[model samples]
Target: MNTTTIDKPATTANAPGGPVPVCHVIKGRVVTGTDVEYGPARARFATPALDLDGMVWPRREPGPAFDVPLAEIMDVLVQTGERLTRDPDGLLAEALEFSVLTSPLPRSVLERSYASLGRLFNRRSMEFQVQQELGGADVLDGWREVDGAPSGRRHRTRAFPPRLIHVIAGNAPGVAALSVVRGALTKGVHLLKLPSNDLFTATAILRVLAAVAPGHPVTRSFSAAYWRGGDEKVEGLLFRPQFFDKLVAWGGESTIRGARQYIGPGFELVAFDPKTSISLIGREAFESDAVLADVAERAAADATIMNQQACASSRVQFVEAGVQDVDRYCALLQARLGVERETASACGNPLASDLRDEIDGLRDMQPHYRVWGGYEGRGLVIRSEEPVDFHPDGRVVNVVPVASLDEAVHHANVATQTVGVFPASRKVALRNALAAAGAQRVVALGQAAMFETGISHDGFYPLQRFVRWVNDEG
Candidate 1:
């Protein structure tokens, strides 16, 4: 309810000579102050101080959102989605301009990502997610009878909304929107700790909801702000179960490690652990020239999207091909990596000097290793008998020649989130083996980033972990 001049230059990144005011939305209220803070040195940008006091709800019982009808929340979300698509207030536009300074994504790619936020809020998507993930909306609304009990007693259960603190990732701006939608759909009181890389999208989406339905319980259930990760002063006070029920964290090892220290008996950690994706190319790709070209393009899509920054982007590919065919596929994939797409740019961030040096060292090793492309962001592919020792990034892909696709399974483990397989049909044969090896999702080549609704992420249906199941028996 606090009134601030949102249209003034002082409120946006385009401000004449000051750091932009990154305000916090606390339970349907906006709180802004004069304190200044900067993001990471690599992508530094200034923002106003976080309103820490406004973050936590006072009582232990559920907030107003717990009592709201499921149908009503859906309507408000659908309307909010419509408004987000139109971007009537230009918040999304302003956020995009601000985000480019913090995020590594190109302006065009960021625009496309922000443009897709509206689809997540639609009625059909929401209904399907609830039905598929939690069984149905009825379970969330109230208790439902269970059909069987060994004791011959009838029982009922509800997917009770939990108090969640989401440490959302910023690799792609869509994560902020998705987190907001999921939190609201589960009817939880969510405090989103926005990542420095994407400081605006979550707040922008929350503002859209606030405008669409002022004072609505669904809108009131949400809040978002930023703080340096691992700030003990802030985390020490809020991480207890009395204030929150779960810490839904997404980031690399360091981020997850920081959150792990706070976990205990009452509060749980639902971690989207750090993961890398890979690709498997069967012998079918080399059957014909046309087929090989098509397969290379598909492989490029999985490896180059988001400039290999996304967890789902393929960093390593195991191709069942000879020396000549594997080299040919590498060339085709390198050319396709620099092309523009909805989620990728023509040119991406340059490869790091260390990674470049490693690739340079491989040049002297004869038939054991072959390199194609360069470090200029047009994409780089290194073919070797084994995976590289260093992590691949900046549109760089490590291609390994495997005797068979089955051999690729040995390289997969708990840290592998996705495995993109060529010859779409090959997925059926490899999915079971891949899953046993700890890979959560086996996607068809080119479709690693194109996730379907109601599917599991990082080995589990997230919504199932986000809520508490309570049962009553008679």
Candidate 2:
């Protein structure tokens, strides 16, 4: 393992007039400015929450001086990956454990989530991403002609790294880690705007980087801080075109909307909007009693991803089966949602009261629609003729019975992120139409969250978008 003597500079976590510790990184330095104490908000659904302890966010120039060549960055990442693989109990692992304490996820879920991220760090995986996502690794070399000369002029391009501001969503810890990886792979000077819910993971990861390779280009090129989502003071200073080339945001409507004022000619916004996913189960699932049970189990697996907090988690199911068969499937799914697994359990997050009331109102008004499970929020299943009006989150799913698989396509829109289909063979029949309707991915029923390296995210190759394709003619 390549180890460097870590030089952690002495700095105050608490500012002179601040209450809690304020944490922010300036250049390569991790400084905690406690000039303000933001929140002791709910990281989980219950008590024993976390407080926002950082404040000072400084703006600085970003350009070639801050950029690390891709080759060097890749080497460092490879070394870090080997170290983590050899000793799972290193500082990075300890930091991840601390992050989990502030998260709402159960212990098993956190373990699974962390392991998934760990697998993404190898040299082969990074090399594969460069090859698959952006033609080839040579694209990082300046001005490579991608196509034969047209009309006697050579057309060449470079994937130039941009100065990016990543507005990370706090729903999942993986987002923070992935943002760091993406920033390093692209060799961009990353300024991460931490979400209120997650303040530990990114900072912890930064510390780990500093430890592994002190003052390394990857360390110097990264920064992270927190401010209110729409704070005019912070956004006004940092969002200016002079400071950043791109604002990569991952959040709901308000977060995306808040970034619009800062975007114009010099700056661009690459957004991963809030999306909902569903499952399409064909009638073939009921061909045998055994098959029906197995298919229902797979549907349950998709429905409970991150306890239904993930965009890829199936919130609804459109089953092309009879009412009786669908009901049997729904019952089986409800039971499966509550089962314990090494990474997660079906006994998940609590359902919001408003959603519970809406479910109750529907049950009261429509006698035809049957409901299973209570508002205690472990897991609930509602059988309805059409998709439910509300967003099905918190392990609650709406099983909508359809006459044919074609009808399920209507519910899919530009906002739909993933579609898990049963009888994997049917995916071929429905794939093109779903893509046309704006769905990004289609997976086998139980594999909504099981992603391989190099798959496009939210309908685009994100790494391809992360860098600026600078073109030159010869």
Candidate 3:
């Protein structure tokens, strides 16, 4: 492991320092790291030089390693942990202000960010700013009854101002931003271990935070830095009794499994779990054939975002029998996939290698699973000649063949994350069935990922899962 440093004054707004290097609390010691820029995104780290915008960018003159001793490192972690477990109010106020500023992010760019975490981190920053400056709308309040209160006596409430250890996965962008914002709601001191794939987010967010609250101690309540997620030298050293109160993670099977190393008695593990999504078409989709084509165009739009890598993006599809009538459905979907040309978006890191590996293995067995669109950019589509298999691949899309709407509902297994139902009525049957089948979200066939703020990801109303509530039992 290379321990690198650079001399950067804290006044430089371009990265992490200009006069004094902007800081975040980790454990509670003042360990410093500088910003490393990459393409359109930037992150904070102690690395001397970095790959930025297709060139090598070194922030400052290199120097010898700063081994401040393990004991000191322990103090930073312990102190920050103590701050979160003991007093979180002041820090939360600052975090809230920053989170509110993040809501105005463009859906288009948000779509492009995909696995390149810097963009996702940017997304998180966008959400963080919105929450900090404007406070996101109360998600749970949308279902008010005539009296404007809980529908019945089911008015139960819980508040968890818990300290957190965020295990961010490099799989998607903006994930770290989400975890960071969640920690801030508790005003909890944070120990952020950056995933190797998208390391720039913490720096971008911290730099922004320092600018937003230059002198606030809440800035000291969190320590956001970059380190490999599986470096057990660091993990074994820090994932102990007094270091954290909760471990929050987002990713696939390996990531969630790896995060468990830091979990025990007082420190709990909260995971997003492994998930997937798809679309459902209804016969009413052809209320008019032209309308069906428009719906087909929009459905293609939903699938193209982030190249359908998101758990919220559609992958497994079910079409109505009466509309395209199975054969026509496949033909229409393929035509739509070709016409809409969803595979044209920019991408990074090429989706997950594991997903690609899965496709590589399956394509050898299923000839129908051939790549059917332009083979560059986000222009590749995968279609099934048989019920074959659905292994997600790089910017590759799949159009699964189902016998009927009823069979479509039958296929709503545990892998479903979001399902877009056309005609919207079939949703009455398919949505609940898929919900029972383990889906996290359901939407109009074309609006899978664009369901507004409160629609729910997995099972949590984000505000509830990501924030704190003070209830005075007066």
The best candidate by TM-score is 1
Clash number for candidate 1: 0
Off by over 4 Å in 2: 1-22, 40-69, 84-101, 365-367
Q: Which tens-of-lDDT digit does each residue in 1-474 have in candidate 2?
A: 012111232233433332233356644666743334455433221111112212212235444323456677877776665554444446556645655556667667766665555555667777888888988766775567756665787788988877888999877767887787788888777888877666666776676666677888777778787666897756766676666788999999899999887899989999999899989999999899899889988888788777777888898899998898888988888888887654456577677889888888777755468888887657899999878777877889999999999999988999999999989999999999998888989998999878666668898888999998898877
lDDT of each: 0.86, 0.74, 0.49
Candidate number that wins on lDDT, 1 or 2: 1
- In candidate 3, position 112 carries an lDDT of 38
Q: Can you write out model 3's per-residue Cα lDDT over 294-408, one digit (the tens) per residue?
A: 7767676666554555666666555555322444444555455433222324432344555556656555664445544443334345556443354544445565555566677
Poorly placed runs, candidate 3 (over 4 Å): 1-160, 286-288, 322-371, 385-387, 451-455, 461-474
TM per candidate: 0.95, 0.88, 0.62
lDDT order of candidates, top first: 1, 2, 3
Winning candidate number (lDDT): 1
lDDT of 1 by residue, 1-474 (tens): 122221212233524554545767888877666455465435545545555556777564667699788998999999999999999999899888878866778898899999998998878888888988999999999998998799889999999988999999989888888898899889989999988778889999999999999999888899998777998767877788877899999999999999999999999999999999999999999999999999989998898767777899999999998878899998998889888887789899887888888989998897898888888888888899899899989998899999999998999999999899988898888889999999999988989989866878899988999999999978
Report the lDDT of model 3 for residue 219. Answer: 47
